[model samples]
Target: MMKKLENFAIQDFQNDLINWYRNEKRDLPWRKNQDPYKIWVSEVMLQQTRVDTVIPYFNEFTTKFPTIQALANADEEEVLKAWEGLGYYSRVRNLHSAVKEVNECYGGIVPNDPNEISKLKGVGPYTKGAILSIAYNIPEPAVDGNVMRVMSRILSIWDDIAKVKTRNLFEEIIREIISQEYPSDFNQALMELGAIICTPTSPSCLLCPVREHCAAFHEGVQTELPVKSKKKKPVPLQMAAAVLYDENGQLYIHKRPPTGLLANLWEFPNCELKQELNKTHTEQLALFLKEEYDIEAALQPLIGTIQHIFSHRIWNLSIYFGEIKSMESEKLVQVDEETIKQYAFPVSHQKIYKMYKGEI
Candidate 1:
């Protein structure tokens, strides 16, 4: 069972937080309206992305697919194109799938019921709570990392926030003290506090409105209260990529497999180098091209290397420029710059393309 705060303390905390929020909240684009669709888009984009970076993408996305029907009717490729630089391609895919369901089953309206909304493809507990509370003013607790930090500090809860079970603990505490009359402002206030004041490191405790009730602050352990285990270091990987050109000066690129890292995106053909190759990088590229695509090529290394990092892997990429002597694979397409521009390439491959065009 969760520890209960005194009734008077809960009232005081709610009043101070809500009042501070009304006076100090930033004028964000999503805050301009309470449309569930717009709010849902913002929430999805904001995951694992900073607010400043999300603003332009959010603006572009909403403009392109302003309504649930607009998003549902859009081709998956177009949606992926709009989300090209976002890095997390799966989010857009799931969002697209969910929106199609909403359009078909719910008449293009985001479901307000908690159970119904949670059943959507990408809607988790936090997302369901955010939509229900912010869009419909339902008294649901939105416990994101920000909210978790704020609550953990305020109540001095030492549970590991990284563990899935701890989310319920925080959610229960939030449900106990949430402002029923103003659930939107209350949850946003908690998130805002964590973002601006109760930060991950060196929190601004002096400016905190709920400082009086913050047990961690009084106990002098605010920075360490919300315990999270450290993540393992990313595994390093060596990869060889080929920037193949044909007699007609067209570049060779192919789509990735439909469901994995960088799924369905266009990229220069590449292969993982398991260990240090006995041959030169250029020779390795030639052999890989012949073995994988049955294409013979004269290969030379580019002037520099391209290193791209993902969440769990670091790609130490060596790029090679090659002239294709003969073509064999039907899967590989040779296209000019105009045709290439029509396809969405992963950022790592885009770097190679930029180098090919002398842009970097």
Candidate 2:
């Protein structure tokens, strides 16, 4: 059972938070309108990404696909192109699939009901709550990391915020106290407070609007209330990428498989270096070319190495410039810069391309 909040009035807390929000909230682009489609896009983009980075992406995305129907009508490649720099490709794919469903089934209107909206692809509890409360003014708790941080400090909860059960506990607490008349601003205020004031380290407790109700602040433990378990280290991987050039001066590129990491994006011909291939990078490239593509190639000196760090993997990529001597298969295509520009390349491959063009 959850403990009841004490020593402070809920009504006063709500008023203070709402008043501070009205005066101090950042003028984000998504706040300019209450359109559900725009709001949903912003919420998805803001996941695992900073607000400043999301601003340009949100603006470009809205400009291209202003309406749900427009997004549904766009090709998957076009949508991926628009989301090129955004690391999480699956979000864009799910958003694209969800918009298509909304366009066909709901006449391009984002459903207001929580259950109906949650049924869409990639629409989790938090996303559903955000869309309903922020766009439609529904009284639902949007418990993201920020909201959990703020609530954990206010109530002085000691549970591990990283655990699933702890998140559910926070949700229940929020549902009980969330503002009914102004759910949008109320939830945004909680998130904004966590982002700027009740931060993970060295929180600004003195400047807090609802400091009187902050149990952790009174106990002088605001920074330590929201406990989270440590994450495991990312696995390191070594890779070799070959920038193959044909006699016609066209670069060889291939599309990734339809699913898994970096699905459907184009990339330079590369292979992970296994323990068995203990040869030098150039020797490995020669072997990979002969075995995978049945092509005879001569690898030039190592051009450079590009380091790309994903959430769970760190790729140390060694790039090599090579010329195709003879071809025995048709697995890879040779394309010029103009043709390659039409396809979305993963950021790692993009870095190699920039190096080839002397841009980096």
Candidate 3:
């Protein structure tokens, strides 16, 4: 049985890595402060998101919900609106719930304990350890994908890093190698090294400061150490939506189903296309209302077609403002402060709403 590589000059590694980071580290908004709440939010938002992609959203979110208490008290729709277009709606939901827990249990301050933080919804071993170490300076090594790739190459671990047991083994290796003097810096250094230097596809060993210590580099397998399992293709779906409006200038949007894809977010009266778009999309949309909601309206095309891709499905939408005959909105879901504040929406609608919010 092969034991893990438990010995390395962790301090030396940390020092050299931080020195490199001083010059090469990307200037991220979250790195500016050591606030645990902000770090927690950034980490959660950054799950499977690129740093460049998350920057603007992170800035907007931090500006809107400045504190954990704000996030806790905010309507779910507001959270979802903020999170619109960002896939993994469940993360937003859990982040909201976890903020409530922070307000209730931790008294508005995100706790410094890893285990306590881990108990919150959506937080795992990585997030818990990251927040504890980075924001609170706890001695936990937060091993994420970047850290894992770096580790697999450094130690020449040829096992598939995709499996939970294999990942757990790597975490154990990190646990043993983490330094006492500067565990947070060491942990971040490993992650940064992995991200910028020891990338999965083609590593730049010449740029790596620790190439001498990297076993995979010595064995000419730096690019092949951290093997991953294959990913399945995302299922495609035929989804449609309409932006209904009347003479009063109020748009007639429906509330989504209370759970699942875009739960509780507002959308134009949308329908599932069981058959392909056989006729004019606008004509078919009017017929859909006549059949399902028992109402008719003069629908005109205004909002352009927009497509939003989630992790699993794709939404191909065609929006039009329908000028319906004078009738009260008995069928439309009444959006209220209580009901509107949960569930993320597609980014297109959110963008339109933001532009037209003052008018609406």
Task: Compare the candidates by lDDT and give the number of the best one.
Answer: 2
Candidate 3 clash pair list:
75-341, 76-341, 76-342, 77-341, 77-342
Candidate 3 to truth, TM:
0.83
The clash numbers for all candidates, in the given order, read 0, 0, 5
Sort by TM-score, best first. Answer: 2, 1, 3
Query: Rank order by lDDT, top first?
Result: 2, 1, 3
Q: Backbone clash tally for model 1?
A: 0
TM-score per prediction, in order, is 0.96, 0.96, 0.83
Residue 288, candidate 2: alpha-carbon lDDT: 86
For model 2, what is the error of residue 359's alpha carbon versus the real structure, in angstroms, after optimal superposition?
A: 1.8
| Predicted candidate 1 versus true structure: per-residue lDDT over 1-360, tens digit per residue | 345454338888999999999999999999999999999999999888899989999999999999999999999878888998887888888899999999999988999998899999989999999999999999999999999888888887888999999999889889989999999999999999989999999999999999998989999999887899889889998888989998889999988888899988889998887555676666776778888899988786565689999889999988788888997888798799788887888889999998888899
1-360, model 3: which lDDT tens digit per residue?
236555666566667777787678777899999999999999999888888888999999999999998899999868878888776778888999999999998899998876678889999988988888888878887878898888888888877777888878877887777767677677777877877888878889999988777888889988677888886666665555665555556565676776787676666677766566677666777778877677678776645656766556677766566666644446675343344445355675664454334332
Off by over 4 Å in 2: 6-8
Which segments of model 3 are wrong by more than 4 Å? 6-15, 276-287, 300-305, 318-321, 326-344, 348-360
